[model samples]
Target: MSIDFLKKYFFGDVQSSSDVSSVAFQQSALRILLALTLCIFLVSEVHFLFTAGDYSFLAINSVYLAALIGLLYLSRRYEKATAILFLFTLVTASILLLTLSNEFHAEKYALISLYSLPLITRLLFTFKASIVAMVANLYPFYLITNNSWMGSAEFLDSANLLTSADALAGASIAPSFYFQMLTFVTLNIGLPLAVSRIIQTLESHAIKMKDLNQKLNSHYAMYEEFFENTGTPSLLCDQRGKVLKANQLCRHLLTGGIKKSLAHSNITDWLTPAGENSRFAWQSDMAECTLKSDSQTHINIRRASLTEHGHLVIHLENTTELKAIQQELESTQETNSRLAHFDVLTRLPNHRHFCQQVNQRLAEHDKHVTGAMFIIRISQFKLLNKQYGKDNANKVILSFAKTLTHKLSDQAVVGRLRGVKFSCFIPLSQTYLIQKNLSELIKSILPKQITVEGNKLNMEYQVGIAYYHTDGKNAEALLERCEMALEYSNSVERFSFYNNNLENKLIEEHTLGLSLSSAIKNKHITIWLQPQVNASGDICSFEALARWQHNGQYIPPPQFISIAENLGLLPLLAENLVRALVETLTDWQKEHIHTPIAFNLAGQELMNDGFFAFLMALVTDKPWLKDRLELEITETSPVMTHPLVHKRLRSLSQYGYSIAIDDFGTGQASLGQLVDIPANILKIDRRFVFPLPHDQRHVDIVKSTIQLAKSLDMKVIAEGIETKEQATLLIAMGCNTLQGYYYGKPSPMTDWTSHSNAKAKTLRMVY
Candidate 1:
């Protein structure tokens, strides 16, 4: 091994200054002490063999040398155990060597070696272990001093003989021996203890310095890494604005590339000041500066002190792209603000914006400044859309908006309130004049023969006006009053003003709606059946009709039905009516009556899938009820055009419930709708049937309707047969079923049962 390797192996690896008192240090110190002891033993053995020709001292040294070698070998494997074992060996070997030396007349050398034991143990081990080793080593010396073993001849003779003749010739050896022994004890034990304490204090200071140096190195490494790897451009400069050190990013940003050293270069030479005072400052604490480059690029430079000696750190950030992005963000915000206040299609104030403006004006206006709000509703707009399509309809609406904007630009604020509806706020004094002007503008801008997409269309509108503070105080209230006035206006009436009478009627309608909703829930609405008879005058089926009586006065069907529909309570009313019909049918079933009863369904009821599903669930277990049930729907119901409603109707038909189209001729159902609808029976409207046999036009229409129904495989039943003549005419016209006052008016189930029994008895008598 190399000298360095050997040193490391025998002692320890080079320890940091901070680790001088660590376990490795202690072990290295112990190993060195043991090595020195081995060298001393070798020197003593050679000296004794050459000068005194005594092999005993050499043998003692040999035994100790072997133990030291073993301790050294063990030190590499188990340092702590080896250290303790070495201390014990030192104490034990000292006692053995002292005894052997006394036997060989070498008491002086033995006493010297024994005195070193406590010092070696204390230096290498704990104070307690050293004390125990010192006591153990003193046992031999105690025996020699007390003459405990001198009674033996061998010990007495060895003790009497001295290594030097001068000591042996002395008259009394005790005093001289005592002086030499005391001197040896002081030098060996006291010197080692004092020296060891000094070494320990020095090691403590070394450790503190090593720790401080390591901490400094760590901090420096962190700063170096941050300087080189930080994404931002950085430079370390002196007070003169000269670059002392720069990171890679700083080089690339300032000089394009690191082709040459940037050391001691004046930083201000490459940058122009953004302000009028374009001079570089020599003194700096912390400041932000804007600098422009040769390529017209803008840079933000932050200069801050890095050291007490006026060294500064400069950070560079490019602001060109950031400024562009900020500009784009501001532009986007502006566009969004505009969109929030104006309609995207017409670029006019929208409903929310219009309401805000009106509210602001109302808050600012005095009581003397009376203003009026006008809501212009485009009539037949839905029909126009249906005919010309949405694209052209939008074009027409846009044209109307443009006309309003142009005509009322100076006099009022105009806005598109909602679909096909526009609003204008103008002075109440000029209301009449504005209305007249608008009428003329409407006539001129929206002509009767206006052509769009090669199709001529007639445009019409209705205008409703509500005066501010008189009709309402806020925008919402004014708008609601305008809508109410518009609703009350007729097709012929182009404009109307808000009035108190309309509000009273609305209150009455709302009151009626509440009453109807309660009546439906309480099952006060009763079912009345109108019988439909065959040509033989035999009652075949009864059509179910809903009748409501409140406080002994019957409410008309049209009024209550309209009220129910508007209140969104039509489904509840329909369900209660169906329940009554089913109960009546169940009674008939119990009496063995197989007659099917038809119930009317409104358009809204037909659209409710839940209603049909409820009916199916109610009669799911009663196959007889399903067989005897019939559903009658008006032909004009908008639900008939819906594919989902049509599917549900077909499903009901498949479930064995008869489906009928009532008042067929009164509705505007297309031929295709009539064909596609799943109906087993078609009831000709009473309008045509009431004038039957008298007007040939009515007669011809009924006959043609019956022929159409027959061709479609549907049974034709003529309704409103109030006379035998009408029934006879319908029977002759291929209509086998008739329903009207001629047979029986709609009556309660009990009354209908009595009339049906009476009719049955009369028919029996005739047969």
Candidate 2:
């Protein structure tokens, strides 16, 4: 075999990268001893064959050689098993040598190896194994050496464990025996224990050294990687702030992209006066500093870390973008604040900001303080809008606002409350000062004329003033009180002060408006029929009237009608009235009553899209309704007077509705205005009919109205005939129909529909 192969077989490559030793020294020691013992036994067996003619000893040695070769073949793969078997092989061979020494009566030198068994066991294995080998060797040695054993003297005398001749003679045999016993104990127990302890200490120290070196290498690699490529702008510096090493970010930040090396430059030199105030320093806890460049670059020290070598490493962040963002945020906040408080068109403080300013001014004084808050309205603004267009009106208002701003004191809080209305808070803190502002100051400040589209328009205004203490307690209350007073002002008076009576009037109107809206929505307003009969008093038709019984008190028609018209709720009221009329006519038609029912329509109702569409849809769906449903327009509304106003009524006339001009004599209709009125019937108003048959002035007026209706080929119905005489006089005056309490007063439709025949018979006596 090659020397390398032989060496590998005897001792495999046992060095390992791991901390644990790859090859146990005990296994190696055991393998070497087994090889040596096998060779010696082979030689001894050959001697036995040649000298003693024992051929069987050679066969026995062949088995031992085979065992040695087989164990060596598996030793590298199974180290623990091979090592234990090899160790025991040596023990068994030693035992065999003793046996041969006793069997052949050979010298004591054959027992030499047995004495070294304890020391070999200690070197190859643990102390427990050494103790076992020591005991095993002792038992066999006693058997071969004791005096009482058969032929023990031949084995003891001839076998010299000393290996040197004449060391002990026959006379010194006992001393020689003592000497051999001493050698056995020392080799088996004493020498093995001493070497085992020394080996253990050296192995432990070697392990600690290896761990320290590995930790040092790991720390060095981590630092090297972090310092070179970390994203943060970082610098490695000494205590004096000299740049030792810098990351790529830091190199670009201070050294112009690393083109100029910063090996010896001080980082502190870049600091402006503000940044110079916070010098970088090392501390046990994480520290920070601020710095600025010469070019107004903002730099912030995020952290400063101390390295293992006691050097400082500072990480910086650029905050210039964040500073710009902060400034932009502040600008946006300021703009939003102004938008929240000021008017978009005029750039003036709105109601909310005006209230705040007023309260602020009032808070500067005590409870005794009193001033004036005026609710100023631009006079006839809506009229101006119709005359010159809304765009031109807006320009006029803008000019007025600019004039007020120039003339009013800075301390005054003047704000536009809503369209065409402005509020001015004059915090004079005295009654005389408020009067001065009112009598001469306001009139002189506002110009008498403001031009619109190069045309001079007269400037006029009305003011409603509310003073503190007597009027209200705060700005909100004061402004509300001023509005209450403004409701009482008219064009003649031009101004009014808040009083308790005005507040009561405002509350009454407010409550009535609410109740009127509810009544229209819920159909609570009852439609009453005032029977209009022919001259014979037979019920032919009915004039429908609206009535309301709210809170067990009757509300007059005139009171609620005016309220409905003013509140822009006339369409809703008219809708309810028409529904009542249609329902009554349908029920009467079922009873075979062919009388037509007429309900009044405001001039504005025909123009309202929702109400007009509803009327058209109803008529279209029930074509029979057009013959029964009659339309009455009050003459005072200018529907028959204005040419465009009667056009819608004429369309209705063509649709089979008998249009009537109601309240005829009272409408101020001239002959020219009466020429084009599309009327199928003319009803003389109650005012002219009330004094009929007695008052000569009304007699002539009613006669003339009836003659005018006759000439126009229209039927005449005299309204409000309360007495039998008035009804008779109206019937004699060419009146075809007469309606009044003389025949039947206004009652709910149920009363007339249930007893129409009986009521008509009773009303016939009046004629």
Candidate 3:
């Protein structure tokens, strides 16, 4: 077994012992004494039985040796009990040997064994046990020496005790022997106990020192790692500002300085005057300072005391990058502020800035003081952009702004309000002179033309003026009035002034637009059908036109139609008209009349896929109505070029519905453009059809249009056939259909129903 296991088995868990070292020392002493006792007894037994032929003394020595061996075995299980037993055994052996020496007259051997008992007992047991064993062993010596005890004892008389010459000699020397024995007892017990205590104290002190040394080593390692690996530059300094130690980061920071190593260097040499003064207090919890080295490098220093002995720990953190970032952020903020107030392209104040300036000026105005604002808009600017591209177009606008600003310097404040529109604010006193000057400036600039990429481009402008205190009292009101005047100005007139009539007209138009949604919802919009006739004068179909009547007065179609388009209500209006016409056709079907009805599709309605889907869904269950339905499209519709419009028209035509191009001649569409449109009929404009046979120009135009329709394999329908002569001329010109007053004026479905029935009957009779 291992030594630790053996110690635990003999000592019964040394940690549980009050003092482990003391217990270990006592155990070692007990084993050594026990072995010595056994050896001494064995030698004595051999001498007595073999050399002297003494059986009694030999048997006693054998018993003593066996007891010592038993003690050795018992010590493993019960150390304290075995220790007491060993001490008792030592005392018993001494007493027995002494008694035997008296019985056998071998006093010299007995005295020698008894003399070592005190030293062995004191080393093995505690003080009290050692003293008690010594006293008990002394009683045997007293009994051997005292004659009275021998006489009183009956066993002593029967034992035949003899007094040899050696015994007499021992008795005569007993006084001096007792003195020496007493001195030996005192020295062995007291000296061994004192030495054991001293040894225990030394062991305890050594253990504590070892533990303290381990703790110090662990702390030192942690401190070393922290100082060397930390990113912040650090240093240790004394009370006099002398540097004691510096970490790796601190050494790197001071590499290029006058003193390469910070150790033993005065800290004041590196710090500014303010920093050195701040450190004079030394007791401050924390202080910040700046360090400018001899190399001109800047360092931010943070210092604090590490110990009460006036030791300071300094940390350095570089802030150069942080300062640079702050400067960059400030620059970006300035740029953003500039962008917010001024236009980046033209370098003029933006619309918002202009509005703010105008409001500020108006707030500073006194009563009776007046100012004028002009909104100058470029004419055909979109066309110019398309011709020269956006870059050259912007150049022209920039040139115009620069020239205008130079001409009106100090007389007005000008700003670009929006694309192709510039706004100017000036005192009313200078309005006439500024206006004349602007007119002259534009005239001179137009003739010279704006040169962009070596190309000369001509531009035109129109101006609208609104005077404050007369047109408006605020910036928004003035700008709105100026826009109305600009829209109402004639093309020939380059400028116009805001008047009360234009404002009143705008209010009326706005009011009409607001009521249009309710009119459509209430079904006040009705369809008026104009009949179309073939060459034989038989009615073929009727064209459905939208009519509105409100409060017993009929509103003109042109006025309300434009209003509806501007208000983005064209889809709703077209759907209402289509529903009315479908209902009228349904009624005609119930009356056994199956005439196709054509309805106009607005530009916005054609582009709206949702409305087209709604129309298709309405006729899904009434598939037969597709054959009697015709959709007419204006050639000038902006949505005509849209892909969705082309897709819907083709889808409708594939579903057996006829598509017709209305007012074909007046629109800008050419024959090539019409070729892609899925149209079955081309309607000749009313202007060409109205003058009929008498106006040869009109006659030739209609004839040529009819010929064009024939070439495209499309039927030509002549509109505005007011007279029989007009109808006759259209038919002779090879027009397939005639639609106008010659057939029947546009009337409600009820009036057209009766007229259509009479015409059908008359045509049947003629046939």
Worst ten in a row by lDDT for model 1: 758-767
Model 3 ranges with Cα > 4 A deviation: 1-318, 329-338, 356-370, 430-448, 473-477, 487-496, 500-530, 535-538, 547-556, 567-569, 572-593, 612-625, 642-644, 689-696, 721-734, 741-767
The candidate that achieves the highest TM-score relative to the unseen native structure: 1
RMSD of each: 8.0, 10.4, 10.8
Model 1 clashing residue pairs (backbone): none
- Model 2 agreement with the true structure over 566-585: per-residue lDDT tens digits: 89888988988898778767
| Rank order (by lDDT, best first) | 1, 2, 3
TM per model? 0.68, 0.56, 0.62
Q: Any residue pairs clashing in model 2, and if so which? A: 107-159, 108-159
Scored against the true structure, residue 523 in model 2 reaches a CA lDDT of: 89
Error of 1 at 181 (Å): 8.8
lDDT of 1 by residue, 1-767 (tens): 69988788766666533355546666776788778777877787778777866676577678887888888888777878888777667656655765554454445555666667666666666555546655665566676666554455555456554555454345667885597557555745565567567656766777877888799999999998999898898898886778888888878777756376778687776666555444554243333344434454566777754678778888887776887788898979978888899887777788899889888877787866777787888888998889878988888887767766776636467788778888878765654445565445444533444457776676778878787888888887888898888887778787787888888888888787888888988888888878888889887888888888977899998889878887877788899888777776676666566678888887677677678788777668787887777888877766667787788888888888888888887676557668777888998888888776889998888888899989989998888888889888888888979889989888886674565445424433222
The number of clashing residue pairs in model 3 is: 0
Per-residue accuracy of model 3 over 415-504 as CA lDDT, tens digit each? 888898998887665544455664554455332466778877766678787888788887778888999989877679878778999889
